[model samples]
Target: MATFIALVSALLVSSVYSAKALSSNYYDHTCPQAESMVSRTVKKAMLSDKTVPAALLRMHFHDCFIRVTPFCLAFLLGCDASVLLNSTSKNQAEKDGPPNISLHAFYVIDIAKEEIEASCPGVVSCADILAFAARDAVSLSGGPTWDVPKGRLDGRISKANDTLQLPFPTFNISQLQQSFAQRGLSLDDLVALSEFAASLQSVCPMHNKVKNAGANMDTTPVAFDNGYFELLLQGKSLFSSDQALLTNPKTKALVSKYACSQEEFEKAFVKAMIRMSSITGGEEIRRHCRVVR
Candidate 1:
């Protein structure tokens, strides 16, 4: 019994150590200027196109969701350039997938990568770039800023079928809960991410043919405020999924809590973003943001 206990303890410690490969200062030694460089690029893009904020945030969410929910490590497509891969005769990449069709801001990442490679060479990963770019996008658009951990390696494989695990725009509260849970997120995390969904609704409004799907999710459609929770309380959210949060007893409490306090929502949002950034596990730093080196 003692021998078995010791073995289990060792395994637990080993797992914890492996997960720590990613750190907020991952580039502190390798490419000290990476974050600032990515930030400059993201701000420039957002300046040229106001829609870049929504697109960049959505881009990060889709990247994390695609590989985290169902088969993250099994398929090797989290946050890597796999999602940016072009379809070929022998390979169907996630870029061509249905859930990813509306994704924007690929060029922003490309621009950042180009600049980073020019200065730092092969020191950073595309996954880390995506995270930094996403954070900068938020800060540039009046959203909360958070430190992004780095040291993620770029993944080599991408498939269109792997993206099937992404939650649909029509998911209800229960379905949304299940989808988030699959990726090791809880009900609170779902509430926090719903804030992001609300933010995107303004920028990615559906066409008039799609009925009520085109409505702005909150009063401040362009800002990253707690307007989502306030809108949920008023039962005026744009999507059925956003409205479903109010129907659930536990989620309803969370929505009310976040609505009353923007600081609480910001803390939760930062934690959730950090958790999502770690979904890729230990990976290599890719020189290129699109093709795996």
Candidate 2:
């Protein structure tokens, strides 16, 4: 684990990306209604279905994890709707992969995209919509909200094999750290985002046969509190990856701190998310999310 962290630190310095292209007001001039439209759509979706918050949040993570940064141009996949593309006879899309089989909440993005198209007509990109919806989802679900920098361009490619880049549910602390580090995230960012996994267990169950079967990822799974870190302290974690935090003295100390400090957790989480939102550079806005314009 020591070696892995060291390697990740080196990679972070060498692979650091410039988030110069994105801005909080990227859409203010072209489509002032974009962000509010996405927020409204997400709120409506979550209101209609309580699971929307968790699902949307998961979808964003899955998108970001594929390339470590959703808008990263180095890798083909990002927050683009490529993940939503259906599998063809010749090739499978990311959604068809076994690991992504449980990935839901595409309809929510569709709804937001459609509405935005009607209002702004080919102005907002699917990549930006994803970032916005994700932020709103977390905020509505009792989590922190961060200003998402926009102006990300959607890519045309969507491949199933690329989904494999994501960390496995069984990844150990070292593996998890390496994965996040590849995306330019630090160990503290890993700990901060760990709380988001609190609701993941119920969506992705242990037993294949009982897919829907699950207990809360923590005592207060419904709330975006420090319950996840609290559960870790008690030796109760939904995934091996979550439990692995305790095996490392540093991460374990972070878990203890976040468990007791809501303000601290929220601050770190917001910072990490802001960093994640910077993966995509300046790209064109797609008229349609699923297909690049």
Clashes of each: 2, 1
Supply candidate 2's per-residue lDDT for 222. Answer: 41
lDDT of 2 by residue, 18-120 (tens): 5436778888888998888898888766554566776777777777666444234456334555665567677777788777898777888888889898888
Q: Tens digits of per-residue lDDT for model 1 on 65-184? A: 665434223542455556655677898888888888877669888898888899889888787888898888777667788878777777777778877888876888777777766655
Query: Where is the poorest 10-residue window by lDDT in model 1?
Result: 206-215
Clashing pairs in 2: 71-280
In model 1, residue pairs whose N, Cα or C atoms come closer than 3 Å (at least 3 residues apart or on different chains), thus clashing, are 153-283, 153-284
lDDT, each prediction? 0.72, 0.72
